[model samples]
Target chain A: MLRLSNLHKRFGQVVALGGLSLHIPAGCIFGLLGPNGAGKTTTISIAVGLLAPDSGEVDLGHGGTPERAEVRRRIGVAPQAIALYDDLTARENLDFFARLYGLSGPQRRERADALLARVGLSDRADHRVKGFSGGMKRRLNLAAALLHDPPIVLLDEPTAGVDPQSRNAILEMARSLRDEGRTVVYTTHYMEEAQRLCDRVAIIDRGRVLAEGTVEQLVGTLGGSSVVTIQTDEGDTRIETADPVGELGRRLAAPGVRGVRVERPDLEAVFLHLTGRSLRD
Target chain B: MNAVLAIAIKDIRLLLRDRMGFFFSFFFPLLIAVFFGVVFRGGGGGGGAGSGIPVAVVDLDNTAESAAFAAKLIAASELEVTTGLSPTEAEEAVRIGRLRGSIVLLPGFGEARRRPFWGEPMSIELAVDPSRAALASMLEGVVTRHAFEGLSEMFADPAKMRGQVRESMDQMRRDGSLPRAMRPAFEMFFNALDSMLQTVQEDSAGEPGEAADPAQAAARAGGWQPVRVSTRAVSARPSGLPTNSFALTFPQGVIWGMMGCALGFAITLVMERTRGTLLRLRIAPLSRMQILAGKAVGCFMVTASVAATLMVIARVVFQVQPTSVIMLAAAIACSSACFVGIMMLLAAVSRTEAAGNGLGWGVLLLMAMIGGGMVPLEFMPGFIRTLSVVSPIRWSLLALEGGVFRGFSMAQMAAPCGVLLGIGGMSFAVGARLFRPD
Candidate 1:
């Protein structure tokens, strides 16, 4: 579990995190959803003690900040950029990070092997990371984050630029980590991912959380009722209502209806309605 | 500690995988060492037949005094003189740059030497090449030193000095060189010298003017070889050939090898930052100090290992033996520490891999050029040698040279080793203070 209270970070004239506060609870996939440049990476960075905030406190649920080495040991970070030594083999890379976490000798080797197999990279364990495909590198990067099996894992856009297969594997790994009762802090600009994977989601923009709730709860809060559009010879009639089934039945029984469409509310609609701009922008 | 060791080991493994780094750090220096070793071995052994400064000591005077002066030129461990060459031949040699210069002992040189008491000016012509402006002065100093030594040797022989004084006095009595008013003083001085010479030369008492043992005197004078000087610098400045050419060149090899390691490691630090591994490292359960210490230790280990490998190759393949193993170890440790500190400073200043590799190596190359790693300090210009004191390479080379062949004792070795450690400490402190952990 990680608790960041009133975090304020500035990069010269640019404000990276504007009085941001986030509390990622234990044993759940807690998603920090935002558009690009929404302080997601900065929040993760501060949470892992990689960058100190200008002002505010980061509590790792251990009565101390991640600035302390022992507190950092309880958390794992998968940075947005693929952080790996290109010259080292996958096994060597894992073994190295494993050793940093205090694994040694046979234990180091075994952990590295297990992680390699877990990421579906056991066949290429001896191959240098330099020769790996982008998707393969993404998988290896995730494995490296899980090398030490820490209590909490912070994954910063783990599936960015990965192939579909690697994306599936990474998503599955995140699910497995959650199933093992490990707290997962996932940061990304992808709205659908948060809707599908996260138990609780917070939409952040300009370094401040706009909304925090379950996906259905967020959509219900601001997404409004589903829009029922009925196209007839006269024209199309649009209606916003909670009872879509009864409305659709009445529309079907009515005079000539050329076409019909039910636009259900989702996170995209919730983001657009809340931010007045598309999430991709 | 475990994390630190892991980082250090990882860096070393990466370096080994880089072909260019591996070659420059190991095989390139080895090539330089082996090539220079073979060349110096053939010529630098204690003034072997043709060692030292190559020049022609043409005796135009052809007298016993001039010949003895020429022999002194050959006796000096600094010059390698060719006696039989005519003035024309020597001049041509200088014109073509085959020799450094030529010194002609003209006609009146012997007469001037025989009657030095009369203030007779010696005739000499030192035809130094135009390109070598300092050559004239350097040769003159060497030749004049030998001439002054001859004068001193004449004085040491009371009888010979007395003979010269009497001849000068007779000439002065017949000629108007001495004024009439000063005639008595000059005669009195000459007569007093003759009397002292007679008493001292005839005295059997072994005090004051006792006869020197011929064998001991010859040994002290370094055995008059009339045409060449031997390598005495091999035994730390006092006659003999360098027994191993590798001894003369391996120190230079270590210097270049250290440069490669320093620049390579510096670039690696920058690369890690640029590639974002530094972020991962910082996020890991390791402090900034531990991370930096790991880097410094890695560079130090690699630098020291390269030096040790070069020395081992020198001993095994080139038949070179260290003067003292303990002193050699001390030199390597201090020098490696200094370069590791330098690597830290370079890494702190470099924001990218290109800057670390290009700018850092450029700085090191300049240091090597000024510090006698690129060329012998003796042959370097005066300004360069003066600037060399600031370059760590100068101290590294000096320490290594002392260990390899300079035969420096522990007490003698303290200065260079101390300076090396001092540089290492200062650079590391400054680098660590300036390093950015982002």
Candidate 2:
């Protein structure tokens, strides 16, 4: 379990975290969703003790600020960048990180082997990181972080440059961690990843929490009775402040519209309606 | 303890695997050591023989005596004489450093034997080039002694002049065989002969008044009588053919290699910082100090191992054995610490690994050049040698050479070690202050 209250951070004149708050219960896959330049990374960084917030407090488990060592002992971090020695073998890399977590000798070897197997990289464990593909490196990076089997895992866009197969495998690993009663905090700009993986989601932008809820709950909060999407040859795609579904449905019926379906807002529609911008933007 | 060992092991492994780093840190020094060792080992007063020395011959008179004197000079081993070289050529050679000196034989130099002591006698002159000042004095003494010997031999040839001396002596003895009036004439002649014998004796004894009193003679010989330098080194300065330029340069090479290790790992630190590896590590609950300590310990271990290996090789292969085991260990430790500290400082300020590496190696090379690693300090000016005192290479060399050369007492060795330790402590403190987690 983790709780962040009224966290605030600033870099020179720019606010990175504007009194943002987050709560994560035990044994759940929690997603912190945002676009580029959002405070998702800053929040994650502060929680992990890499960056200290200008204001507010962080609590772990039973509602108290976690000691640095205690937090380190119980948490595994998969950084956004490749945190591996290119000259070292995948197994050696795993063994090194495992040693940092205080595992030694036989225990380190055993955990390194197991982690290699878990990541589907046992056959290539002895290969140097320099020879690995982007996806393979990403997998090895994840394996290294998980070598110590900590109680909590923080993954920062672990599948960013990975292949779809690798991404799916990583998603499965997150599910397995949750099932094992480990709290997972996943940060990414990919809405699909969050929608598919997170039990609960917090949408953040410009260092502030925009919304926090289940995916369905967030969509319902958009307050739209029905949603309609129309592809037209006309340049103007904007619908004026009238009943969008009514006007769109009338237009479809009058013209050569091929498909029409009334619907509740999807995550993309909800995201646009709430933020006044496209999800990709 | 285990953490330190792990970091150290990892660093050494990495260093060995890096081909460029390995060569710079080890092989380059080995090459330099071999080069300088061969060039500087003593033979005919440093830099070996056939190193091109100049001698000037000045003939004031065209007589046989002077010409014969010049011929003897040309015949002497180790003297290179130029017959056509004018006084200007001789002066220019000494001036521009082409010639070491010129020999001038004054007109009637042979007549100095026939003259009484009054004004300055007609003597051979030795003109020297001051640029090679150290060699000039030595050459002056050598050439002057040779000229005097030749002049003496020219006057002493008895077989060619025996008839003139014997005729005069026979006439004097016959006249002495007369009465009282003739006895007075014979006594005067005998007194004249007595004076000539005394002059010969004085000349043979080399300028009579110049001989020192017994006390003065004893004092003059005392300073250099026992010319032994007390050294603590296990082995003496090796006998036989002297070491070359490579051997002389080897210590510097070792210091340079150690510096390379520091520089290489400093780049690694900068890379970690720029790539957010450091930030991520910090988040994992490791304190900033632990991260820094890990890196420093790793680099130190690599440097120490390299130094120790170099020492072993120097001893077994090159016959270099440092006398004081404790001093050897201490010097290595101090140098390693200094190198680590320097790296930490470079890493702390650099925004990127490339920048750090460039700056670190640039500074290292500059230091090596000035510290007498590339060129001998003997070739450098006094001011340059004075400046080199601050270089880490200077201390490293002194400490290492002291171990093998046995050229220092504890009193002499203390300053070098002290300066090395001082440098290590200062750098370590500065580096520690600058080190930050992020």
Candidate 3:
């Protein structure tokens, strides 16, 4: 279990984290969802000891020492940036980090080879990262973060800028990590990703958590509404009327309507209704 | 050792992979080295031992005196002397770089020597290029020596003719042909004759511009000779380069190079901080110190290698050998530590890579200039020399060049090394204080 209590952080006049708190149960894929500039990064930085919160404490589970070397030794982190050395080969970069983690020569080589294979980059192991595409770099980034086999993992928008296929693979990897009993704290703006991969989700905005729970629970709590959508050739796709649910239903009932499916409010609609903003925003 | 080796290999690999950076690092230093090497070679002043001087002579006194003097110059290997040059032509040739300098003998130069100017001493005007002014006095000596040698040859026969007078005086005195009172008058006449003969005979020996014997050169020069002050340094060690000024300057090149390497890493570290890689590393069980230490070790190894490589090239390629290997190594180690500390401080203080690198370059250039990298202390204006004492480069240069030139004994060198070590320790402490991990 990882617990943050009343964490407060500031930069100049801007309050990046305003008395925020959270608890992550062990061995679960926990999603931290927020809009851009939503203190997701600030909170993660504090958790990992890269930043010092003005007034709060981060307690890593299993006797984790906050801001201590031992705590860092037990955790793997995949940052949003392409953190691997651009000039080094995938295997070389991995081995370098592995050695930093105190792995022996033979062990580092073996682990680097295994991780490259796991990331589907074994064939390109020797190619410098400069030649890698956004997706490949992200995959390698993930592999590097996992080099030490840390029991706890933190990923800050690890799938950002990645293709849909790579995103799927990465999300699946997170699931696998959770299944293998590693406590995972993942940050993203992608509601669909949180829905697909996380057991629990916390939607944060303006340095505060706005909502927290499972998908159905949150939808139900927000008084889930039904949504009707239609496709047309017209470029003007706006619903003219303020309440288009009735109009949408009547149109769906008309002749020549090929498909009609009533949709209970998904995470996107729930987010809009609860927070008065779209998930993407 | 393994950790240090890993870091060094990583640095080399990264630098090699960056095509533009690789080109700049290797080619830039090499280009500067080659350029300076050629210029110093051509300058002749940089030879540090003797001059390759070529002089033109305007011999107006062609009366065997000047002609024989000119011929003597032609015979000697050092001077490439030309004859029959007018005063203006000789000076013009020297100005145009065709000649290092020139000597113009005024008309009636030998005749003037016979009649002393107002019973006072006079000197010949040796027209010279002020650009090669360091060689002016030397040119004067060369001409004086040549003219004196010719005069010595002329006086050789006169000195031999004096022996006949001495023999006649001895025979007259032994036969008792002169009265004692008459002998006194005769002795006075002999004294007068003796004095006149000494004058004429000495005048025959070329004192060049002086109307006296060449043997009086020491007295004429005010107790010093026209000869060079040859110095074989004992404590103030002589470098391969001219002057001890270079001894205070050359080490700063290594310092600047180390600074460059350190700045490279600091910039990289700042970039990592901005991009959240540092945060990622933190989360991955790598403490702030580990990240910092890894980078520091990498930079230190890189800087030390560059410094050592330069020293080797200076020794083998330029024949600039270090007097003490241990001292050189100590200086390099201290400098490397200082570089690492400064880099860490820059990284800690900066919010972005550009700012860090910009700050680093500015500091490095400032230190280089003040520490005797741009201009040697011997050549610097007085105020600048006073200002250089505080620069880390100054201490580095003192320690390193002192080691190379044998300018300081171990006890004497301790203070410079201590100052360098102090700088390193202070910077490291400040950097650590500034370093913050959440």
lDDT of 3 by residue, A100-136 (tens): 6778989898889988888889999999888999999
lDDT of 1 by residue, A50-77 (tens): 8889999999986879889889888888
Question: DockQ of candidates 1 onward, in order?
Answer: 0.68, 0.31, 0.39
Q: What's the CA error at residue A7 for candidate 1, in Å?
A: 0.6
lDDT of each: 0.81, 0.68, 0.68
Q: Write the per-residue lDDT of candidate 2 for residues A1-281, one digit (tens) a residue.
A: 88899999999999999999988888999999888788887887788777789999998766545446766677788888888877778987777676667787999999988888998999999988889988888888888778778888889888898899999999999999899999999998898898899998888888988888888788677635554655555532443422666677576765545555445555666667778876679
DockQ of 3: 0.39
Worst 10 residues of 1 chain B by lDDT: B225-234
- For model 3, residues B1-438, the per-residue Cα lDDT tens digits are 344455456766786666655544444544454455444442422212233355676677656554655666677655666667787777655533345566665555554344331222223457653322235556666666655541332232335435555665666678585777677676666666556555555654555655345445333432122221121112233343433222222454566567667777777777666765555556554545666777778878877887787677666766555667787888888888888888788777877767886787888789879876655443344467668878888777767765666445576567778888888778877986796533
- How high is the TM-score of chain A in each model? 0.94, 0.86, 0.87
Can you tell me which runs of candidate 1 are displaced by over 4 Å?
A231-237, A253-260, B45-141, B144-234, B237-242
Docking class of 3: acceptable
C-alpha DockQ for predicted model 2? 0.31
Better of 2 and 3 by DockQ: 3
Over the stretch B288-397, how does candidate 1's per-residue lDDT look in tens digits?
98999989889999999999999999888887777777888999999999999899999999888887888897999998999878876656544676688999998998
Model 3 ranges off by over 4 Å: A227-259, B1-9, B19-27, B30-34, B42-252, B435-438
C-alpha lDDT of residue A271 in model 1: 89
Q: After superposition, how far is residue A14 of candidate 1 from its true place, in Å?
A: 0.9
TM-score of 3: 0.71
